[model samples]
Target: MNILVMMKVTFSTEEEITIEQGEIVQEGISLILNPYDEYALEQAVQVKEVYGGEVTVLSVGPKRYEDTLRTALAMGADRMVLIDDPALMGDEWIVSQAISAFAKKERFDLIFGGQMSIDYASAQMGPRVAVELGIPIVTTILEFTMDGQCAVVHRDMDGYMEKLRVPLPALFTTQQGLNEPRYPTLQNRMRARKKPIVYYIGEDLDFSHEDRQVKTVSQEFFVAPRRSEGKILHGSLADQVKELCDFLRFAIQ
Candidate 1:
């Protein structure tokens, strides 16, 4: 089996949010493999253990993202493919296109990724890549089972469970409850440092001009205004009601 795991590197959870020039400043901030994507990596590793196959992790980010890919390799993934180029950064559509382009050159029985990137939470990449590959997609999978070329998946829709069966060469976006991600051991971490990481630039992929463009543009970003403390109503119920009514009237005005 050939499994490909799509992952993202994002700011560490403890990092403070800092905005600059209408964009989040990442300089000097600690980055790690996206927590949600870790689940996909864990699942891929588990699948590889059971089926005895190669697992490859793919990511689109700067060279720093190699740390994230290394961590995945330490967790038991076989190889890493990195599309490292700042010019390739765009919205979900563009990212998925690049992934699809590279993926078309290789054969994969399964592709996995997080349900949504923690940074954007657009929940579009997996579906978009599925469209580009003309394959079926199962999002937010809670239970996964495979038998030969067929996969049985169970997902949560609202509060109900939905079961589905899809053929090989399918894509899946993992949700939080799917599995517990394993931490990379020190031994594996050291070994991963020696693993080779294949790199590619934007020009390497065949993408149209429109596919490379970012669809959404941010106008501005500012911290939300501080909220005022609640006022204490000290008096009889009638008096308090009267004060509340007056406050409401003033607020509406």
Candidate 2:
């Protein structure tokens, strides 16, 4: 089983992120692997433990992202790939296009991703990548297993727990409930420090800055969305209830 774990670099906060000339500002901020993707990688490590295979951590980002991928290697991935290219900054679909293109070349057996990235929280990248590759995919999965030549995925739909079995060579977007991610032990970190990384770049990969070019650009960079002040209505319970009701009625009216 050749497992490809797709991860991403994302900011830690939910707000209007500062962009210096269309690129994310990173002066004093820390960039971490999307937590959901961390869970996906941890799960991939576990799968390798059971199935006897290699875990290849893949991320499409700038050259600086190698540090994060090295961290993933420290955690336990057998190998890593960084699809470093400036044009990947276009849009999510472009990033997906680049990854799916790379995946096609590898003939990997399984692809995994987190339910969503922290910053966007749109939960679109994984499915989009799968679409680009024309592979079957299941999202928001809580757990999964190999059953013969199929994958049995468990997920929560509404309030009910549901299980679906799909064939191999599929994509899965893992939810936080999947499994607790493993913290890299000292020994693992030491080993990861020396692991060789295979860098994937623009020259060899067959992808263009064209094709659904989002034409997306930011006008300016800002901080967290401005918040409004809340007024507190304080008084006796009965009086407060009446006041709140009066305020609502007045506002609505």
Candidate 3:
């Protein structure tokens, strides 16, 4: 099994977000692997361990993202690919195009990624890549098992579990409950520091001008206003209901 895990570097959720002049302040914020992508990478490594194959991690971001890629390698991936190109960086549409281009050149039996990136939360990268590759895809999968050349997966569908059997050469986006990620050992971390990471520039990929065009015009960031304290109603049930209605009406007005 040749598995490719798509990963991303995102802002750490533990840090506080600050906006200055409609832009996020990134001077002192920490960056880590996308939380959801950790599950995808863990699943890929486990599959490789059981089936005896290689796992490769792929990401598209600036050179700073190499640190996150190194962490993925320590976790169990064999190698990494970093597509570091300013022209190729854009919205999800353009990023997916770049990923699909690279994936099209390589052969992978299975492609895995998170249900959504923590930063964007668009939930479009995996499916978009699958669409570009003309492969089958199942999102938000909680459980996955191999059945010969097919894969059986369990997903939540409107509070009900839906079982699916997909053929090989497909894509799957992992959800939160898929599996717990493993920590890297001291030996693996040492080995990861020596692993090779291939870099790709925009000129190397096959992309037209239209494909590189960014669809998003502008984005703004602002802090949410503090919520007001709740008010208590001291009276009978009818009076409380009347007071609540009146309060709501006044607020709306």
Compared with the true structure, model 2 gives a TM-score of 0.90
Any runs in candidate 2 off by more than 4 Å, and if so which?
Answer: 14-24, 208-212, 215-226
lDDT of each: 0.89, 0.82, 0.91
| Lowest-sum lDDT 10-residue window in model 3 | 214-223
Q: Compose the digit string of candidate 2's lDDT tens values, residues 37-70.
A: 9989988888899988899998888777776677
> What's the lDDT for residue 211 in model 3?
79
Cα lDDT, model 2, residue 21: 66
Candidate 3 clashing pairs, residues 3+ apart or interchain: none
Clashes of each: 0, 0, 0
Question: Which residue runs of candidate 1 sit more than 4 Å off their true CA positions?
Answer: 208-210, 230-253
* lDDT at residue 155 of model 3 (Cα atoms): 98
Which residue pairs of candidate 2 clash?
A: none
